[model samples]
Target: MGSGPSLLHREDIHVVIAGGGYAGIQLAKSLKNKARFTLIDPKEMLYHNVGAVRSCTEPGFAKRILMPYAPAFGQNFKQGSVTAINAAEKTVLLSSGEMVKYSHLVLATGSTGTFPGKLPDEMITVAEVTQKSEAVLKLVQEAKKIVIIGGGAVGTEVAGEIATDYKDKEVTLIHPRDKLVNGESSDAFQERLKEVLQGLGVKLVLGERVTNLDELPTDRVETATVMTDKGTEISADLVIPCTGLKVNSTAYKDSLASSVEDNGSLKVNNLFEVQGTERIYAIGDCTNIPETKMAYRAGMHAELLAKNILAQETGGTVKEYKPDPFIMVVSVGRKAGMGQKGSSLLPEFVVRMVKSRDMGTGRYWKEMGQKPPR
Candidate 1:
């Protein structure tokens, strides 16, 4: 894998990218013209997880978010999972028992979390997600009192959607941290978010840990009595947990065992290449890049990785990757939200205009080379 006549041809360069989430798709699209590429994922449709929170209350919204991969990648996309990576052989084993060879392998397998924040592995299609949302909506409608565990962005959004849609239902959001979003946001942003959620009839129970919540199943809406460390018992017909995300790195663990971090994330250098491996890279939420895991950051990783990969083929100097400043905008129903850009807190109207209106669904649809629904 040196600079030679074989490397000069773009068609001869095969870049195999694992995962079809934000980073994988963006990287594949960026390298489509620069090299021969293949994108592998377990699912056929690219679930726009940003809009998944809104889908629980809004009927028919799933169609807009869950987009088909065929339109974007065509034959270059393979609907399967990357079971194992053989860096020594320069190939990968797919779950379907097929061996796909590659000139460069990019490990962009993102993290997995609970529903609404992230889709389950079993839900591999738009239809499955749509059906699940419809079912959750039914539970939301029928339940008298609903409880959401965790005060992260996902939990806050879930509480907001349920409260906004069903004003009569008693909605309570419980968090171990005093401030919302795990207290990661600024004071101004957190205060404003609390005001917005309270205005929507959502009860805030902060700085209280749900002691028995770990024993309950969070995949579905179940009736349970959750007790807090402060000796408070809140009974609800529906309970949802928006917990932490687990990194998806099983494919790389066996062959590149030493590259995996203590937290189960892959160790990558400033160039976005997996540490101790040449031409094998990792990006998105799966990498141990010291920054908040967000879709925008993953997109940024894709842009830089594409440039570096192309630069390497031409024997050009590779640029080091730098993470952008922390930025986040959370949607609270359709018209309300909170955001922070760098050290400044964004105004409510700006947040709505940029994200709260439609959670940036149209932008992603356009990014996939598809026209957004009118």
Candidate 2:
């Protein structure tokens, strides 16, 4: 009834998507019918980390968040990480000793948080973090005191979720700056976030420099006591460090004509393509795109790149990727959040109604071709 079967029989278009995260999966889906796609990722499943913060409170959400690639893309899925990329050869070398050739390559390797890269390779996915979530939750469940080191959205959300859900827990958010949600949000937005956190019984430890983690116990269920530069110790049973993300581009560092920024993100061109490379493109947290590394933006970038690549192949005008100005919707736990659309700070109710309720899980489910559960 459709040209899909007939088109599948022909092998004209070949696309290789590295890193089956937000950007890679969406881009692969966009070109699934039009091209022969090979999705490569170290993990067998595609993790939706948009709801990662909420997963700390709702553990069951973890299963729904991680969507497997094999079911979504069929034979196109390849279970392995890309060890290297050869722009000249237009091929990607896998960790499994297999080399896959590509007509076009998309790097959507995403990123990891400020965790030291000392952990074994096996525990890397959202599942690993989710598995640790319960242990972390157990600490929170028993802890009378909690200290969140970092005042970003993730840190704020973590503090809020804990304070709101587990009211018994004493949560204290420590930031090195004078105000919370620095750089990403406006002053008004930061004030609102601080107000919300304070209202929900979270101790706003602002203008404090954490010199060291002195009283963090050696046991698994231990408190995180941080010592300030002024020799003041703020102790808590649980400490969730929400620093920044580190882009995963080490594999392609030597192979491609790529330049890393001061923050370690790869610099890409207007077309989302890595500079000086025709067949290669970088997206998501890995690229130094002038945007917040959100899942929605990554999906948008991937879709744009896939369309442009297909257009280039078929002799159509290529579309350029101009990132929309920074728009952040941060949830201060259930039914409360702060959003900044460009420079405009939307009301807290607007943010809550749009994003805070479900952590954008419904949007992700629909995008991934799954019917969101009622």
Candidate 3:
């Protein structure tokens, strides 16, 4: 059995997870019979952002991705933003003026990114997300020419999803680097991604910087002329900025005696524990794990952290978390994608089955102990 029944029962071994994201939810779920857990987050639902880019094009997808924490976690889940961490006192200060005590602390606070890729930073409810999805779908439907200012995973995915779904729409992807995936992926994988996107009629503008990118508005989809640094002008009806992510590690700064990296990531040891603290640990995009900040990688972190935490409690063999090699599965649209693991690129069929088909929503729904909608 999971921790649902023993959530409030076992107060002695209480585990407080700061962020109810991919890593946080997985960690809490993995500690089924081990400890009682309280998951804290500002949002009511766990937005499966891996599939968020696709949601822009597909209608009613936002409701499918935005999963509530109530089903699996029940009363143990606390809906609030973690304002600060009182490490000395072992309590997490919430924005709701509530102090949640913990015997073990896991800082799984994930990073923040722009809309359609990542949700808005403000506190969100399920109803609001559904409304936003409908609005974005309408925006995509009306847009004849779409410009995505970033050729990263989010940007490429956005371009692919929009272009694939609406063949009449002119989709252009702009990236600062000469190659896609920021030169992090293998040569073959990058080439494949470019080929697939181009096949879908996505215009690629590589090795060019969007000078007026910061000035562009992200709130509402608008008709504007986007100018690049190289004097190229593109008229766009809808401009989506895949500006990347910023780590949310403010709560760890004041109370915890640990070094926060210049990139705002928490420095964690090989055991996934914060450098200075024994009981306190950090994982996911918020930790300097030297891996791609993907949802799957965060899930991997939770799996290991759960075992290590159990080992510490039982005085058993504690294991070290070795950073996995750069493994990525970039879903282009429903039918096409590219992926890489170590030096080898994944098969197109594998990519389609694993990610491109439904953006792995079914798998995640199962992981969260819920049934995927038919």
Local distance difference test values of all predictions, in order: 0.85, 0.74, 0.83
Q: Return model 2's CA RMSD, one decimal.
A: 3.2
CA deviation > 4 Å runs, candidate 3: 1-11, 214-221
- Candidate 1 C-alpha lDDT tens digits along 254-373: 888999998779999898888999789999999999888899899989988887887778887789988877788898988788889787898889988878788789989988999866
Winner on TM-score between 1 and 2 is 1
Ranking by lDDT: 1, 3, 2
Q: What is the per-residue lDDT of model 2 for residues 76-141, given as tens digits with 9 covering 90 to 100?
A: 998887888877788889988899988788888888763211122475565685576566566667
Please give the lDDT score at residue 303 for candidate 3. 83
The count of residue-pair clashes in candidate 3 stands at 0
> Model 3, range 52-138, lDDT digits (tens) per residue?
887899877877798888887898888888888877788889988999888989999898888777778674798888788788888
Better of 2 and 3 by TM-score: 3
Q: What TM-scores do the predictions have?
A: 0.94, 0.90, 0.95
Model 2: which residue pairs collide?
223-237
TM-score of 3: 0.95
